[model samples]
Target chain A: MTINEIQDELIADFAFFDDWMAKYEYIIQLGKELPLIDAQYKKDEYLIKGCQSKVWLHADYRDGRVIFTADSDAIITKGLVGLMVRVLSNHSPQEIANSELYFVDQIGLKEHLSPTRANGLLSMIKQMKLYAITLQAKTT
Target chain B: MMEKTAVLEQFDVYGIRKDFPILTRTVNGKPLVYLDNGATTQKPLQVIDAIRHYYTELNSNVHRGVHHLSQLATDAFEVTRHQLKGFINAAHDHEIIITKGTTDSINLVASSFGSAFVKTGDEIIISAMEHHSNIVPWQLLCEDRGAVLRVVPINAAGELDMDAYRALLTDRTKLVAITYVSNSLGTVNPVREIIEAAHANGTPVLLDAAQAIQHIAIDVQALDVDFLAFSGHKMYGPTGVGVLYGKEKWLDAMPPYQGGGEMIKEVTFEKTTYNELPFKFEAGTPNIEAGISLAAAIGYIQDIGMDRIAAYEHGLLEYATARLLEIPGIRLIGTAANKSSVLSFLVDGAHPYDVGVILDKLGVAVRTGHHCTQPLMDWYGIPGTVRASIAMYNTREDIDTLAAGVQKAASMLV
Candidate 1:
């Protein structure tokens, strides 16, 4: 599915849930549906620093778009990564670079995360964007 | 749960629990069994009353006030400095500097001391079991200066390896900062021994005593520490008020942390002269109400006696640990020989968050995550652990409630 389509579905699912528990359960389910990165990509180069959860991310430039795959030891964080990947992947490197992921705020994800977890999420997104920028520079 | 009368007679746990108003609230239709004391403790009535009384009766800026109300307020505020001097057994009141919290206290030391004494190629030694507060400040300092930070590793039992700590000390090591207790693992580090070893190497040491002040007694003079930092909120006091105890000589030697109103002796357009020892570190209008309330909290703790509180909490830890160990597939973390009342564990197949959610539904509040020691968490090779840290007010009944909740959660998850 396209990024906009996934975001629409997320908004719809969020509206369907009346309570926090339901929202959390739905997020976990979304995390379960995240496509796993190939095992070969789970190397030191793709490793994220300073996260308690073992999160791996890899990005590639394919036909003017950035294709990214990610996985995590944590379910919720994996879901968080899935949310990010769904938004950023299959888009032009420039678009992915320019766009802010307001979906996190739209869904109020940071409010639910503990301070440390919120920091980890921020670090992961920052690293992913940095990698995309590096790819953008290479293509230029 | 234990028999009410017997528990009441044996220990004044009920009367003690009554002092904490937040404990009476219901979370998810049940009484809140808050076990996250190591993170931040709940304030008692005495502390709350002291804060209210300060603002209501004695409301004036300290030190410079000449009016009648100002004298009363200044005296009350300075009274806390004397109280903390007695609380930590510091040599003099001038040694105590009020800070925002332990984090600010440690940062003050790192910024001021690091700029003054730490030079390029100098080494700073810290422990593997340190909270991020202790680790990050030194890391930032080392990054700014060309100094390197060497870590004293922990053993398999979650205790600081004394051998490693000693081995890490070298001629180039300028500072050695260590936490008195491991917040994540409940390991009570041999801080005196660590200090002595560091001093032997001619290195100054700072003790992050944030976790230790509540669970154990602290004697800054006896420990021979160069500096010590602790938060009031962790010791049954109000938040935003903490004490930083440094030797008079060291405090006098180091530059002021923040350049602001209170810390200045004279401020001219060309130059500014700083104040003396404690006030040199304290800048801006202080948290006067919280400071006064903290004195009351310290008085309350003193009335109960630190020894007695330690004994009661040790009993609770023993009881809780044994009960938790009986549950199948549970791995207890931080099994140090000398430990605090923290019980951090993980079940075989359940995520720590899942365990925390189930427990919360049963009205047992626990901290689940890396506990801000992500480096230590990385060392353990787990995402996080569910932690139930005990305090003086917690009873055996509280532990029983926690055990039952964990068992129920385990059954559902497994």
Candidate 2:
């Protein structure tokens, strides 16, 4: 599916939860079953610095498509990262780079992205897009 | 949650809990058992009302205007200085200078003291377990001055090694800056002895009381400390406000922290004279509402009584330490002989962030991560620990809830 298509599914998935917290519960539900990053890929070089909790992201390309894998020390953040990977993974690098991530705001996760580095959601998204841009550059 | 315990019987915690409105609230559909007091405290109703009253009735810029409202505001603001003077038993009211918070307070002393005393090859002493607020300022000052910053080591239990501290103090030592209580470890340093030893060597000391102001009684005069700093928000007061208490001799000798409106006597094309003590360091308009409300916070503490607070908090600490230790695979950090209400611990093979997230899900708020004490965390050879710090309002029931939360989190995370 395209990034926007996956994002719509995400919004619908979270729509059942009434409160922001119920959305987190759904996120945790997603996290429990999401594909975790490989142990070898989780290292200092791959670790995102801004998160209060530790988050490691790894990306690779296959047939001009970007595949993402990630993990977090905190489950809530893990859930959020899992959601991002599901949405952005298995897509063309160009699509990942240019796609507007509207589902974050639509599902009410956008308001929760604090300016502080400790929140790390924005930083994770930025890292994913940066990976896409870098990969797209090489492919072109 | 209070039992028939003798020490707790004297303290009316339930009455004190009523003063804080946030205690009655819930987080994530469960009752909020706030254990993040070390980060910041919940404001009592009196402090909230004081800030409200400031906006509704007597809000005005202080020490600048001559109107009736301005005069009232100035007097009320000045009264808090006197309140802090009594709060910490400082020798004089002018010794208290209100600043933004503990970080700003420390920077004022560091910058001022650096200009006057610190220079190339001079040594400064600080402990290993200090908060980033205390460490970074001195590091910046030392880097700027070409001076060396020396650290006093901590033992296995996290107490400052006095022998090492004593050896570190030398004729070349300019200043000894140490925390009155460890924000990360909960180790209470013997400031009186540290001050005395520093003074014997003719070096001045500054005590970072950011963690101790609410839990223990501090006497700048009794301890004979050269300078002391603490934040208002940590002591049931508003944010963006803190007190920096310095002796008269030091304040006179040091240069001003910032050049601004209230800190100046007069400004000219060529030369500008600085304002007198207290006001000299207080350069900006200041957090007028926070300053004005701080007096109510002090009053609220006084009403509860510090002795009673110390006893009750000590008991709660003992109770919590015992309870948290009961969980299998738990390793308690900072097992100092002298400690306060902070409990920093980690479960085996589980990250602190995971534990904290689960505790948070259960409505038990805790702080996780290195707690801005990266060096201390490095000393333990871990990323961080889940920290549960207590204030006067935290009760036995809170501990029970926290224990259950940790048990659940531990089982899942592990």
Candidate 3:
């Protein structure tokens, strides 16, 4: 599926929850089920430090596509990391680099993207896009 | 203890709550249970009205013009300094130098004192749990002056290591800068003891009272502290104004911090004469509104009484500590025997950020981060902990809501 398609699917899934706690419950479950980064890749070199939490993301370029895996010390952040991975991973580097993920706002999680939020989520998205752009550059 | 309970019993918390307009607001569709008082407090109507009054009736550049408004503005601004002198029991009104806030106040002392007193081999001492504001200014001063900065370590309970602090104080120690209360830990440091220890070595002490001024009554003369610094905003006042209470002798000795309009007596192309004690440190046009509004905050606190405020907050702290511990996976980060108005903790298998987000959804506002105390977080080997700092208006109901929110967070996350 394309990035927008996956975001729509996630948005539809989130629509099932009427309460904020229920939405967070689903995110927490997703965090538990995240495809975590390899132990070796979870070092400081891959770390994106935020004021409130820390995130480690690793990207692999294979078969002309970028595959992303990530982790956060925070479960909510990890859950959001899981969502990002599901949306942007296994896509062409060029396509991944240019994609706009808007489902976060639709699902009422846009506050995490605020720079003042100082969680790893905003930087995580930036880092993901940067990785895709860098990989695209290397491929071209 | 009995006296304290009586003070708490007599405290009119709901009446005090009505004074702060922000307390009535909701956050994310829930009734806001604000516990982030350590960051900044909600200003009372008195303080708010004072700000409005300043702009409306008394708006003029102070200490500048020979006009009626200027004289009125100057009188009102100077009134706050006199109020602060009485509030902290300082020796004179001239001892209070208005700065931007606590950080600005600390920087003023660090730059001015370092220039006048510190030499190449001189040492400055600070504690492990100091906020970055307290640590960074001295670090810059030390780096600039080729001096050394020594740290006093903290124990497992987040209390300062007094023995190590004593050992660190030597002939080389020029200044002992430490917090009166740890912002992150809630541990009220033994300030009188710390001051006494530093004074024994002929070292001047600068107390970072940014966290303490609102929670505890401070008497600079009684403590014999050389310097004390605090922010107006943290004490239910407006931001952009703070107090730097220096002894007359120190204020006389150190050079001016910034060379600007009010800080000078006369300026020439060749050499300029500096102004007197407080004016020397206050260089540019000051935050007159905040400076004036700070007096209203002080007045509000005075009406309630500091001892009464401290007693009521102590009861709240004890209640919060006990109530929060009832959660199955709760681990308090700061467990000092004598702490005031702060509770830092983490839940088992759940990150502080996750817990904080969950609590926010429940309309529970808390601080979840290193709290600008990275060294303290490093001491515990944790990234950060969730901190709920209390203020005069917070109640047992607030703690109950926080406890329920944390329980829900723990259940959902862990």
Candidate 4:
């Protein structure tokens, strides 16, 4: 689904859930819908540090776009990673690199995270984009 | 909620609780339930008053002052050093050096000791339960010096495996740094045993007592730790001020951590003579007010008595632990045989962040995350845990509130 369509669906589902559990379930379902990378791509190079969860990300340049897949040991954190993948994956490395994803405000995610977790998320996004930047440099 | 006047009788219980004005504040339009003491303790009114009184009455740079205010400030600042010496029962007052906090203290030792002693193939040992502050500095130092950093693993019950620690030690082991208590797990380490073992191997030991100094009575002489580091904020004192206690001989032998005005005796075109032990390590103008205020905070705690404080907090911990265990779907993370007042747990199928949010809505405050011990979280194979760390100020009511919030969150998730 396109970013706009996914966001619209998320908003609709968010509106439908009066309870946080229902909202959380809906978000987890959104995570399940995220196109994940195959098992073969999970390598040492894809490991991200400073995460409480074991998160691995793999990216491949296909038809001039960077297709990414990520997974984590923790469900909510994995869901977060999946949400990130949905927004940034399948876009050109240059576009992914330059895109200003206002992640904190966009998904209402930071409000739910502790100060440390918020910092961790910021670091995670930076690492992901750094990977994208490396791919962009290689492509150029 | 009991009236402040009625609760005043427990005052002798360390009437230390009365010194903290923030303790009187309300959250969610209700009385605040602060159970995150392990993260940081609330500052007492005496400490706050000292800060205010210092700025209002004696605001001036210390150590180099000829004028009255500067002299008074210097006297007050240095008085804290003496107080710290007595508090920790150190051999000499000059062994105490004030730093930004425990993180800076660990970094100082890593940069100085690691530079001077640690070399290629030399091993520096640390426990698995150490905070990132204690772990990262040594890791960075090891990487730079080509030394190996070996970790002493913890058992399933969160206690450090002494056998593993003993096996890890060798003639090549130069230093062993361990936390007195795990901030995440609340495990109270046998530092005396650890220190004796390291001493037998002719290795120096650094004790990260950041979490222990508040809840337990710290006697550096009894522990015989070569070095100790603790933060003021964790012990009801103001932030930005911490103490580093080193053996006088070791402090004198080590080079100055930072090069600046206060650390030196004389300056020259090429070389400079460093100041005496503590001053040599303490460079630049220090946090004068916080340092002085910390002395008052320490005095307040002493008035209440460490023994009394420990007994009260132990009761609260047992009460909270038992009540927390009764909640269905609630899993306690750190179940060490010996622990302090910290209680870390996870509600089945619920993110710690979500549990924390619900608790906050119910006017409860608890820490939710890795607690700066990501390595511990990795060991547990979980994202994070909700930590409720009680202090002398906390009562049983606070635990009830936390239990109720967890029950509510667990039901919603399961």
Q: Interface RMSD in Å per candidate, to 1 decimal?
A: 3.6, 3.2, 0.6, 3.8
lDDT of 4 at B307: 77
| Number of the top-ranking candidate, with DockQ as the measure | 3
Ranking by TM-score: 3, 2, 4, 1
Tens digit per residue, CA lDDT, model 1, B90-183:
9999999999999999999999999989999999999888899999999999999989999999887899888988988999999999999889
Off by over 4 Å in 1: A1-72, A75-140, B1-9
Candidate 2, residue B167: lDDT = 97
Per-residue CA lDDT of model 3 for B1-414, tens digit only, reads 787678777999999999999999999989999999999999999999999999999999999999999999999999999999999999899999999999999999999999999999899999999999999999999999999999999899989899999999999999999999899999999999999999999999999999999999988999999999999999999999999999999989999998889989989999999988789888899999999889999999999999899989999999999999999989999898889899999999999999999999999999999999998899899989999999999999999999999999999998
Of 3 and 4, the candidate ranking higher by lDDT: 3
What does the lDDT come to for candidate 2?
Answer: 0.89
Model 3 lDDT per residue over A1-140, tens place: 88889999999999999988788898899999876899999999999999998899999888888888999888889998898899999999888989999999999899989987788888988999998888878878
Residue pairs whose backbone atoms clash in candidate 3 = none
Instruction: Judge the docking of candidate 1 as incorrect, acceptable, medium or high.
Output: incorrect
- Listed in order, each prediction's TM-score against the native is 0.82, 0.93, 0.98, 0.82
Best first by lDDT, ranked: 3, 2, 1, 4
On a 0 to 1 DockQ scale, where is model 4?
Answer: 0.20
Please state the Cα-based DockQ of model 2 relative to the true two-chain complex. Answer: 0.36
The digit string of per-residue lDDT tens for model 4 on A1-140 reads 65455655655545666655565665556545654657776666776653344567877778988777887544556677777777778887777788766543544555534445442445556776887899889978
TM-score, structure 3 vs. true: 0.98
Computed on C-alphas against the true complex, the DockQ of each candidate is 0.20, 0.36, 0.92, 0.20
Error of 1 at B113 (Å): 2.2
Q: What is the lDDT of residue A61 in candidate 3?
A: 80
